[model samples]
Target chain A: MDPQSVERPPSVLLAHRMQGHPVLVVGGGVVAQQRLEKLVPTGARVTLVADHFTAAVEQTALQCPQQVRLVRERYRESHLNLEPYWRLILVCLPSGAANHSDDAKGQSKSESDSEKVYRDAKRVFGAQQSVNVADVPALCDFYFGADTSGCPTGKGEGQLGSMQLLVSSNGVAPRYAALVRDELVRHLGELPLAQSLDRLDELRAAVREEAPGPEMVAVRMDWVCALTDRLGLRGAASMDVQEELKKFKDYCKERGEQVKSPSQDN
Target chain B: MDPQSVERPPSVLLAHRMQGHPVLVVGGGVVAQQRLEKLVPTGARVTLVADHFTAAVEQTALQCPQQVRLVRERYRESHLNLEPYWRLILVCLPSGAANHSDDAKGQSKSESDSEKVYRDAKRVFGAQQSVNVADVPALCDFYFGADTSGCPTGKGEGQLGSMQLLVSSNGVAPRYAALVRDELVRHLGELPLAQSLDRLDELRAAVREEAPGPEMVAVRMDWVCALTDRLGLRGAASMDVQEELKKFKDYCKERGEQVKSPSQDN
Candidate 1:
């Protein structure tokens, strides 16, 4: 049995809602910048510690002063004691020029050197702190997919910040996983994923107003849920909101009766 | 902008690899059981606190005694201070009589009753601890997708445990997301996803052995990456692994020369 395979378990994908939460980043290179790009959207209060930072990192910190705090010095144990303790730590330290050359395939020297560094840092961090170390899978508590394209962007109908689709193979076959992700993203673009959702949300709200009774709650949910199928993927994109609301009002009278008048044992 | 929208920020999807790590799950009904199903696959050491548990939950706990620890009591502050303080806490308490009737849509009586409970629990938990309360989106630090079907099931070609394709709308349009997920799963069924990946992995390993040395590292990676395209999606599934390995060894000689003999006007 491969020791490495045993080290890596299946990844449990989650939606981490880190609004107004303090997070620590321990590097300031392009890799660290990439982590920040993902973190900034979550609205996390990030404190970046590094000897020096890239121009992009400096600009980002300057832009989001309140969201980001910069520490212009090397790392120390005391840095962990920052007033508002950071529960999530992203270690973005340099793992010896990996992309610089193919010598990285040498494996033994580079692997052990970086592995030792990553292992040492993981040990020193607080037991409670979840460390996500870059370049080292074994040391990471969680893996950042680090792709923003999954979240649809743009103004009006195209902007669906909530729409998140992810494809992963737990690093077994990342190339294939990425290929499938691209295919899905293209498929999502053709469909009105955001617009349909927005319409359904509005329709749900409208139905709630029309049927203002507790008894109508299940009816509304079931009705809206059914409507989702009726709308399917494309129908809601071209739906008439006001006309649908009026139509829903008339249909509710009959739908409500159907559920109440249960002819058979449920 | 709606106030609800203000509270609910866009979700950041992360692949959490929680193997042999301690996680706490409060409550032990159907909802907690749902959460346990997701956690069990991650190999997380879970401590579930609840007065009573569902049959499924009890069976799972008994089966994986090493992974799950059950506390037959109501939740207390001290539960947070267990020997290994749980960084991730899942609160799965009953949010009133939801699913019982249409009263769930009242938005006032049941909403406030459950909202207050979720809010109060969120406040009492450790400042650093990330809590995921069932149903209360605002109170949750993170949201459990609570679905494991994304990871392919069964054995042989179908057993792609690593192949995880997730579709989410951040709760904005769950119905639509689910519809798309079902479609993708059906699409995945027809493709030999795991077989191709396994073949590619074997090919890469074989090439690394055939073309040994620091210089061949770049050549090996580039060659394997290019082969991924040549093999494409279905091509690798039907590929002969032994024959392919032999071909890769022969190809290495020509590929190495191409990189070395760079043509330039200069």
Candidate 2:
């Protein structure tokens, strides 16, 4: 009814596989540290670009097993290019009066106005070219969703939980990101299933070389329903045809059978 | 780090909640019926422009609480612009020899390259917008993800179960959609918690107004943990803040205390 009310995609950000992408994360304050807390674990080649660093971020960076490059320098617009290597950027900084200063020379505007100007400058310079502004969706390409790292004792036991990307074509509010995360944390509270997903993934990988047939399909169906029930989802209980092939390896193991993924299936 | 190995988003066509957008859905078969099924529920104004209609679809459309206009006309390029409201188009018609013949005869081609032309035509013009073809991503904005509508009864009584959107930013193969859906279905199997998500949702809605402050937060944290632990999650339970607020309302009703939200906390 309203042209202004265009239906846009949900606010979501990609938690890309850290398999080997170089990602540049700007800023090094508490906010930046929060981003690292979630990013580094994903196996992304994370670089922290900032002149100042917090004790907590420094300490965490030091202990991190993954590649975390911390560069202490005043942020400039020239540093925005991390393409071909990095696919994502995150901007983390305090807003409004808290982000700027008042000089002895003279005052031009109020605290809030200065903060607004500083932020606008950052945007104008394209300093946030790859990064999504914290709490602001109109300036972001994605928003991070809440996710529980996989099980503590299963195949991906210690692996960081699968990151859920909640993208908003309409941009996401930082407050909303937190809300969505909190909501997701509440929604997918099942610990055992999280662990099971890991095991299933492992099982899928483990059984990839065995035989393939109708028996595998049947076993795969069982696991599909098992997962739906485990997650407290009712509609996902029905297993379709192709999914059985992907999980053929895992199902074979559960049934103590063996199967090879056919070239055709791939 | 492999620069070229970046994961590309799969193109997906979302059939849910088109809202009031003008869209065209091609075909009158079961698959078309399925797409329309989710669309109507979400309040999408749908028009099944097909010559043949499945009895199920006709009946379902007849029974839907929402208005789903059905146009029983043979598809034509001219028929496309016939709908005054069509904004987005989805092609789901059956295609092969006979359908291809109609299209081939309808268009003129060079005699020497007839076979090549026909093949190209099938790949291009003949490819239904709904087919999830290799290069059709440009024609779509979303993809149909695997959905577990919601748990109808038990603990997950009022919640939407696990929903997986198999999206391809490049829109290639519907098979991928099927594959991803299968994987999600297999992953969620039947579990006690799956049926209880709805109850959790109910509780969440029930407590929204209650602040997650000391007493309530502590209780919620404990309840979530207790439920997950009793249900097998280690410490991952989160409460529906809103649902908790509803409980507060009930608590207030019983004790004659005024209902206060987090704003009142300060």
Candidate 3:
């Protein structure tokens, strides 16, 4: 067995409500800027602790002072003491050339200090907080895979046909995961995914009102399967909701007899 | 604006390391059982505080006694009092039926107990913890969108080609999000996504070694685009890595002049 095979598998979860949550970010570079962009729309109260800020981070902080707070100071152990408030922590240090430049100049003290900061933060908040250290997968409780298109801002008026697609390799193959994600994003908009969902919701409500029972579970599952098949054949964009609803009603009527078998015997 | 448009947009984050973290789950119904199935593989130390357990949860606890602990009691304020230790909390109480049933029987005490449990949990752990209350979107700090497939067990030999896809609707249309997730899962396995990632990793390393410079980022981006186009035209199964590598070398050699323009000016 490959040694990597011993590692645990990744569990993908979607966190919907992050608004007003306090998030601590330790860095002021391009990566930090990217993270801030993503976090902005979530309305997370972001506190960024870094000695310096990139122009982009400064611009963003200026634009949304209420959402983002920038403290132009180096990281210290005292930061982690805010354990009761910060829900998420992100560390995005410079990598590659910039990281090596410090090493080349024998600035090992700063490097070690940053490392210690990461370690202490994790130790202090590791049990309860979600931490992601950019470019350092081993230390991360979470991994932010490549999101080519920035996270969507929740301004719904112009987003009539917009859909967000998240593809995660659980840090396995981020580059590949990203490539597939971009491709799928292109194909997804053509399909009326949200419309199909609305129609399904309507159909489910109808089903519940007309025939609510123990067998509704199986009946709904079958209906979903059948509807998906039809969508697959004709595509969601052209799905006729009224016709499908009529067809679903008929299908439920037929399954009604079968569903009563065990109950009748009882 | 649609009333739903006022809701916050969903943020999709992938958490990779959940090993041995204390997670509190309050409920033992089908949804809780489903959540357990997903959380089991992450190796999270799960403490389920529910008055009862579904047979599936019971069997799972029996199988993995060390990972999962069942309290066999109702939720209380004390659960949130484990503030320093518990990392994630998930509440999967049946909303309308079980809740109304309590009201019907004048068991307002139990009903209020459940509501208070939720309220207190949020209050005690709101700032630092990750909380998701099923069916009650407003009280949740996060939402668990549908994951039809159980979390993959990372016995990595056969999973060389495996990939995890996470689709979240931010509660806009969960049923739709789930349907799209299921459909995407079906289409995903057919693509040579994993293989492309492996090849890209190799190419990135080669590019870094052979053409190390500021322009390398753009060059690599272009190369990935070209490679993806080729993969789309041919297919991942039939991708000739050696041939692609040679083509990449040639492409780099051809773009060598343009890549050097900025350096030459400097």
Candidate 4:
């Protein structure tokens, strides 16, 4: 097998559009609703395929006008009317062949059964379309990343950071990835450098376009971040740091004062 | 509603037992094996319950000394009978509903009535153990977080400033937080702060045990981080500034370092 023929992992800022694509979301519960929420925002013409749905999914379906469609039955290969309408399909079912328990006790499906669904869904969606599963990593084109809203805006508006993906090189459990994702998230949230990067990205566009060179840009960013940390507690540290540096440089040039280096400033 | 009687969100830590406990990991596919990989290290007697398991789960069951119970028949509620042996159950099944596709497809009852098997299995597991279905947040006891395995020690260690929780207050989507986590992890990796924080934690323990006062400890830490950043930088700018500062300080000390005013430094 040639390595060049193998599939590649998705990177940040790939920006694929789902808008206006007739997409089918399989599964009636909250997971399906969550998937729909993301898909709808991307402008996918979503069709809900489930005999029953939670109130949230029903509400979402009602709100979307003609953009959303609902089916009133469990999934069948025939229901997957691969007519000209449906372009993308999202499988949001539980994996079966369960080692834990059976369904009457509200237990999950068997693992092989789950894999069968994954294989079936993948077959329907094919490689060209986005086939995402809510919790099943084995059948997903992409795992939804975590998003941060209401941060002071700069370059990437509504960008996601600090994400976790559920991928199976050998095709396996999505739930296990969930555990890893949660722990990584909590740990990353408190890191100081993550905060600094948030600030660094603000000036990244400016640096890319206007800086004398990449080295100077990198050095200037380092200096700016360091200066921001040196200053007393302030919100929007990056913007404030840049503004203060500009003011200081202007003051020094106007007054003919020798501008002291950071090391000597103390 | 009485404020005192109001229930708050439970703070639960899923402690992986050092001595190991019986953990029934449902689904006998790659995902089940993946769950087993994480569980075995914590010492869990893992039982893979599935009608059909993949080669990986089968191999893991064979290699591990922990009790491996494989039910090759279609799953039923009796599968949940390991209550005396297993208390914690992880449902990684592909779907929670009855597997009725075979009946619809005109398959024989003995060979294809998987839906009946699934329904019976679900009835035994109950809602608390039903984690496989999407939009079943109330059914789950824990949500997993992401991890970065790039640290030099291999063991996930180190702390950041403050306890930060990246929450979706409105519960729009949790995965978007991943993108934020990615940016943060990369940023934190670049900074000296995380390593310094680890050192600072050691100093903090010492200070808390022996320091004269908290204010003194705070001032000491403040100056330490400030000076370390200044000295750690490369290039002539840092060197020239440090040399100038040393000369100024020496000159002042040589002149008897007298402070005639209250605000002056000697």
All DockQ scores: 0.41, 0.05, 0.30, 0.01
lDDT per residue for candidate 2 within A89-121, as digits (tens), equals 566654331324323124345423223433433
Q: Provide the clash count, candidate 2.
A: 81
TM-score of candidate 3 relative to the true fold: 0.70
lDDT of 3 by residue, A37-56 (tens): 87887678788988899999
Relative to the true structure, candidate 4 has a C-alpha RMSD (angstroms) of: 25.6
Better structure of 1 and 3 per DockQ: 1
Error of 4 at B75 (Å): 51
Query: Which of 2 and 3 is ahead in lDDT?
Result: 3
Write model 1 residue lDDT over A171-222, tens digit each, in one string: 5555566566655565566677677777877776667666655445556666
CAPRI tier for the interface of model 2 = incorrect
Order of the predicted models by DockQ, top scorer first = 1, 3, 2, 4
Best-to-worst order by TM-score is: 1, 3, 2, 4
**Which residue pairs of candidate 1 clash?**
A218-B102
Lowest-sum lDDT 10-residue window in model 1 chain B: B257-266
lDDT of 4 at A62: 91
Measured with C-alpha atoms, the lDDT of residue B192 in candidate 2 is 30
TM-score of each predicted structure versus truth: 0.74, 0.40, 0.70, 0.32
Model 4 ranges with Cα > 4 A deviation: A1-23, A37-45, A72-88, A94-117, A124-202, A205-238, A241-266, B1-266
